[model samples]
Target: MVRTPQPGTHSSTDHDPDTPQYEAGAGGWGSLRGVARIFAEARSSPEALRILAGQNKPKGMMCTSCAWAKPAKPHTFEFCENGAKATLWELDQRRADAEFWQSHTLSELRRLHDHDLEKAGRLTDPLRYDPESDRYLPVSWDEAYDEIGRELRALDPTEAVFYSCGHAGLEAAFLFALFARAMGHQNLPQSSNMCHETTSVNLLKYLGSPVGTCTLEDFDHCDAIFFFGQNTGSSSPRFLHVLKDVVDRGGRIVTFNPLRERGLVEFVDPQNLSQMATGRSTPISEEYYQVRPGGDVAVMAGLMKCVLAAEDAGPGTVLDHDFIATETTGYAEAEAAVRAMDWADIEHHSGLTREMIEQAGRIYLSSNRVIGIYGMGLTQHVNGWLNLGMLCNLLLMRGNVGKLGAGVSPVRGHSNVQGQRTVGVGEKSAHMPADKLRELFGIEPPTDDGLNAVHACEALLEGRMKALVTLGGNLVRALPDRTRMEAAWPRLRLTVNIATKPNRSHLVPGQVAYLLPCLGRTDRDVQETGAQAVSMEDSLSNIYGSIGPAKPPGDNVRSEVAIVAGIAKATLPRNPNLRWDDWTADYGRIRDLIAEMFPDDFADFNARMFQPGGFYRGNSARDRVWKTESGRAEFTTPTTLTALGETPDGQDVMTLITLRSNDQFNTTIYGFSDRLRGLEGDRDILLINRDEMSRLGLDEGQPVSLVCAIDDGHERRVDDLKVTPYDIPAGCVGGYYPELNPLVPLGYHERNSQTPAYRGTPVRVVP
Candidate 1:
């Protein structure tokens, strides 16, 4: 069923349009290699100049996340193709603002195509699109803040929801959570819900902690790395540096993914001295296997079965029987279930050979320290929690749970989500109660549970919720069932979004919609008191200060904390006796309150954050003691093995999985198309399997339509879209999210985690 790219798909002169044209560069192994080489060269370049460089910087401002963000002398070519595209994403280009809004009403703006609307570029002013006037009007910050404060003050604290994006920093998030708690609210919906909700839930159950158990420094000491459903070379190019070190040191790296990506095959390390000089690419994966999209749990169970069998056969130095019996529960049950499964069924369902699975198991048995790294690919499945649970099972069996360089790591999307959860931004759970809240903050917090991302959408649609105030993120577009979300916007009493530029969420007109342009991560935030440095919590739960080198975009744009404080001042008047003005003057005062409230983690937040490297929120999982009732890791039993949904009953329909392109982040579309995929200047093309297309009576360049059977049961067909049939598995298709999010059903989500099961959706094709 493997459909590799066709041969002879590239021409020698791809850039020269005057050369004889051929379908040669359409799709093939050669085309894939060419794209990979282009990206590698860009990554290795020393002079990593952004393609969209302009008059903004003093000549040294590069992407902070890119490899070129360091202080070393820049290489000749350092920025990747995607990094250049990301630079274009943040260029000082202007999208039509008050003037364009004046010409078109909110209703008319809603009629424009997604690509066409994005082409309008960045927004410059605070705007309020008026439905009656059929135009967007410029609104003052004072008026907008006043309207938002009044609406928030009117609602019961539980009714208001605060959602965050991946790009937000710890300082802004801390201030946002404080605002909610000050107002006696706890409804916090964030991007973590959609990405790694399962990892947090499952890891907490088994390891007594939610964050990653290992740090980047631990990669140096590891003997084996189980890369479960993560594409390191693409998602985080910096990971290639770590993997290259592992291979150079004779460590084995195993990968379990449906697609054998080129980045994993061989990566030319741009940072390595000898590799960069010689243009030598180091192979990452010693053994790679294609595990079926949702079959990770089953494959992991099989591996655990092999481990237990080996332990029973003979006493070995690798297996720690004493630790297993003392620290973990239900090992015998897990072993029985795994041993009961037939090898044939496991292979058939997992789409992996037994030989390949055995190789992964052998690596685990021989390695002194094993680290499991996973990304959204593992957590976005139907049984994502179970997948994470199995990884914990593997680590627990080998006594690798508590030790350094041996633990589960779920790479996150956002910079500060882990910190936001620490600063009192979550729903009511068993561990976090109202009594604890009263003891910490000196005030009784709300006892009721709040709405999550999914529940917020449902509440908005049912008219149970009246107001929506976003700290940072695109709610309408980021959520599944985009059509219903767009329609639900008008039902709100007020909608306030604090963002950097124009996004699709702004187009969703509320009765009173307000957009407050704010300072970006790279911009300096100056207040009446002085210049301030914001903090960000990294993937390892470490809080560090972030001070931008560049000046603010405009004088009118406010800092996120300032806007939050303004709303708080307007909504909850500072009592002369209680006094809140001092807290707003210095952010350290806020941190002091946070440290007192969460003493277990942030014990000297002010002193620690001032330090150069910042501080780490010490996690007890380093000892491998479960905080659960059992006091040890417990294996969960599933009520149902199969996901409850409409199965493909020989209708020739394929499951569609939408993803973010290399150029784009979450909701921000950096460019029109993905260049690495050989997709030219268009974003609407559907990448299909060549064999599957032929079977469906469709041609390569034919036009087709897609109807969303899941969301609102409406026709979501897009016509005249060119179909580029290429290498894809049968009964499977892929496309970009948000643009194709309307196809996902609202109720289709992971069981325990409430994360959308975006990878597996049954859809029929029309031509």
Candidate 2:
């Protein structure tokens, strides 16, 4: 959750150009040093430290936000910039109780910006808004749960939706799924559907797996890496250090991206003493290729053709000829298509030269083992599934799958975002078979197909969805079509949010709205059994236990697990098969159930997760042990060469890509400034190309409204956007999502994954 403080309640500065670079008596940089001091003081303060240490299940447990705790070793800096943001955000000293909500009406709170609303701080109790009084009144835990149960019981289960964000713990998610199933509803919308659903959906189809095959530590063992649209330095700094080691050891990196971000070219590793002290930066990419917005298929096909040619020539080549023939299918036809294409045409469409393409192939050919890394940049395209398949083809051609250092790695955002889906938090349960969820849970779960994120928004707009229970997410703001959502939010019968801090979602409340606050990841989860530990799955499908340090907000406030358990108990009192025994008492039982559900992977979840470092779920895809019917990995061929789109005549079409700033994560707005882009204190600025700006007769800072060019005839427009001309690519413009979400129609999504096409939406930028 975003924790933007209110005016004067917390310390912050305007975009002052004349601020000092360094503060007197401080040992480091200006605002950073000041922030460091405050963080230290917060750690040392008696009450704060008591809340952090005593409330901790295992007293003195380290924070879960970052790698700050000393692991029996000494370190210079205690936290990273983003880690500090997470720590401060969780440990903020503000409180929003019944009285606070009593004074602020829902309509009045709507007038407040997202930043100011978060300033009200952690919710101290569960609240239900009274439309007559125009304020949210405090409700007891029993009453709150009972009211939600009543609503669920009253409605046709299919009309209600249970939406969740990535931050929810595994136990909470499991319990939510159970409750939803008990009620016979399947409208589970999660954060993963927006981000990595393409990778998950396609990988499951191609490799019979939904996760990355390679681990983070495998970057050290790679000889070459093909980074498909991932900005390691800016997006995930830890990847930067790994890339540095790869570069230092004469490893080659070939980047395939439209925008040539500086972070990819040269990044100064703060972990390196010599580099940081001398301000020397390491070069990450040996060669870079800027692929066209929707031309990833051609770029990958071209690379595959090179490997195929080498294999046909002789035995000594990058690809193992026997393995290609025996293991892979469709190589002949794929090669024929690749060979049929002209180099000049490939270069023309991809916006990359043949020389660069050959250089990338050479990098792959020279390396004994390779790892392919990608992010949303690769998965947000119209042909995202085909792009994923293309990457899989490249890996399969060289027998990269199941190798020690060579595999596919997709860097995921939103901590525990992957976990939510792993534990049956999807529209359809992962634990469910064809008929029902009866085999696993002993009761028939919903057989009705569930609504994903996109479907949920459309359902709300069409007034098909009556009730919404957001476990944790800024749904309206995080989703597209914000303007339509603003109007649609009031149509719901009940809107319940189980959140940590205030965001734009809370502003759009229903007639009988409730804000059920819960504990953060860094806070202790206490229950009758004792200090409880919540489990989470990492990006690499590794499940681990997170024992928070700080105390939960108040006595009235509860852990997410407790809230779900309470709701379940209220809703399922008559069911004999149901068990709420360990629901709120402990989280270990939930882990046991998860282990039961996935015996092959998590055989002993309780023992394995208790280790200092987490354990990994053995990825069969890494070993080429496909879980498909054939028991072998299948080669998928693309039906279409490129993504087909209808561009209106004289519209001057371009791909509108949505992005997150270096300072933010998901939809959580931590800071207004994007320091890397050289924009300070401005979230409203769009990064446009200078050359394109000149050709279009536009200035550097021109405010423009963007309208999406959809073939569906749905009107979507985001007006009053500030455009800043920069080093972006021609026929491409970038803007922050959720903010510019008003321009994207909810139905404008990828074909297979159904994930919103935020990256490659066809739109025209007018002056």
Report the C-alpha displacement of residue 395, candidate 1, in angstroms: 2.0
Displacement of residue 162 (Cα, Å) in model 1 is 1.9
lDDT of 1 by residue, 346-393 (tens): 665555556667767888889979998888778876667777777787
Q: What lDDT score is found at residue 175 in candidate 1?
A: 63
Q: What is the lDDT of residue 534 in candidate 2?
A: 82
lDDT of each: 0.63, 0.70
- Among all candidates shown, the one with the greatest lDDT: 2
Clashing pairs in 2: 402-622
| TM of each candidate vs. truth | 0.86, 0.90
Report the lDDT of model 2 for residue 592: 82
For model 1, what is the error of residue 189's alpha carbon versus the real structure, in angstroms, after optimal superposition?
Answer: 0.5
Candidate 2 similarity to native, TM-score: 0.90
Local accuracy of candidate 2 as per-residue lDDT tens digits, 1-767: 00111111101111112221111211113225433444563343344444333221222333333221122222233334454555566676778778888888878888876766876777888988788877778888888988888877788888889988878878899788777777887788888788778988888887888888887567668899998876554465545656777889988888877655556777765545676566667777777665656667767877876776677777665576676676656766666666677766565555655666776787788787899888888787667888888888888888887787898888887667777777778776564443335665567767668898888888888889999998887888877667888888989998899988877787777876888989887677778899988877767666667677666777777889888778778766476555676657878888887777667777988888745435777788887778765566767575544432334554266677787765565676666756554556777766665656766677767788787776566678777777776554556677886687877767666778777777777777766
